[model samples]
Target: MRDFDFHPDEATVRCFAYPASGTVVNDESMWVGQTRQASPYDTMTEDLVLRHFALADEWFKLNATFDLRGILIQPGPPETSFAINCDIATPMVRVGEDVSAVDLFLDVLVRTDGTHRVVDNDEFEQAIGDGLLSTVEARRAEEGLVRLLGWVESGRLASLVHDYALDTVGQAPHPLPVEHWDVENVPSVAPGTRPTWHHG
Candidate 1:
């Protein structure tokens, strides 16, 4: 197969999910977020150049991965928060479709200055202990997180985000009002089976 250049100006709806309330080791609440992007990939997938990040999130959430429907974002450093606009849903989807809405939460790395870094160690560890994640899967997630930290420390991530936002000027997706993400909503999706597309 030919390699994809991961050209910018593509639009896609992306999701970031966390462990739901009442699950084993339910130390945290649920956070479901989505973004319309000028590129098809998120920071983890874009930075690590691995589809693994996207795949891992889906496996952990036990839900169907949203279809990409667009070009994949290229492997590169992550974009800064300022570079992309995001909408986070409240009362995340945790149980049955007809379940009631609950408080929403996101697993993040918050610096002393109040800036935040998105991270998922808690979910990975909990899943592993619950026998939902294998040793190999946990290791891969750790590796990806470490690699992301390296880019942040070196300041490469900021530069990449700046460049991508600049390049995709006209093609950026229309932003949803920030408040739309705050609704107490439940998702209609059923728990997923092992994905045939998941290699890890």
Candidate 2:
């Protein structure tokens, strides 16, 4: 197991273990992680890098990458894309020693053209119906979605990504310690105590 994990729902958690690297920033207010793997597209020979940005108190976890060649095979120039995971709870939490997780519900994909698409409505509703998420959590998720869409609509998402990427460049990623993990039993952050960041 690694220090970083992502929980798509209460029952599901994916850890960024071995071969993946990450680091905490701004007094543990943020976590940046990256994994490099072979390109899944036949048209590309270069490896693909998937980077994750998890900010404390935010309602979403952001995954950004420049590997658009596979999906945009007809591309004229390469473009970066952002995948936002709208979380039902605090976006990031340290569940244990060197271990953190993000609880997610909905997803939004932002393209380079300023166009975006929201997905996973069915899953979100299913989670609610299945009692996986409470009414308040669902409402929080909805609010997060609205804020995220506002970022997209105002072109702020692009700028945020660009600025964060620039700020992280040349910073070497630190390896997470591996240990026996139990994602199913990870602890939750206390309500009303979640840290937040105000974007200027």
Candidate 3:
């Protein structure tokens, strides 16, 4: 095994994500996001790092876990909302195909500035997915499944799905994009910028 550098100079950065409008960003949507804690031999933060790669490499929508402070960029919603959804069966929470388990670790938040506009919940997930995919290297044709498995174990991602009530294997053979994470939105990055989706 090898060690990985999971350090970000800043706890946060400005970025953009795909909207749930079923279209790739005509233009990048501006956003400010936080970085995860540092860990030695750490892979837990790969989900976040993979997103950074995705953003710099090309347009992509990825599934991820998040701590939404608020509609940092978007505006107010029709009403205030706060909820949590665990046991994520969606691809956003997948450890990998054929190796994901049942467990719940998701959050749902809705808050508005009470003016201008409101952030759509669907859009929020859409943006997060895009943000993660941006950080992660786009899926590989041959190694996509392999990388997914490696990421699952290397990053301690199994904890998220170790205790699912489903009582099934921690794997899903056919993973589908949530309503917003359609394959059309997953773009291939240009040459040179393509990140190597390595697992340590």
TM-scores for the candidates = 0.33, 0.69, 0.19
Highest TM-score against the true fold, candidate: 2
Ranking by TM-score: 2, 1, 3
**Each candidate: RMSD:** 16.0, 6.3, 18.8
Give RMSD (Å) of candidate 2 vs. truth. 6.3
Q: What's the C-alpha lDDT at position 164 in model 1?
A: 23
Residue 12 miss distance in model 1 (angstroms): 18
**Candidate 1 residue-wise lDDT, 145-191, digit = tens:** 55545544665433333322232222223333322221212122211
TM-score of 2: 0.69
Candidate 3 total steric clashes: 23
Candidate 3 — which residues are off by over 4 angstroms?
1-61, 67-139, 156-200
What C-alpha lDDT do the candidate models reach, one value each?
0.28, 0.54, 0.22
The all-Cα superposition gives candidate 3 an RMSD in Å to the true structure of: 18.8
lDDT of 2 by residue, 15-99 (tens): 5663433442434576656554555566667655455676666677776654423221121233433343333344666654344
Candidate with the greatest lDDT versus the true structure = 2
Backbone clashes under 3 angstroms, per model: 1, 0, 23
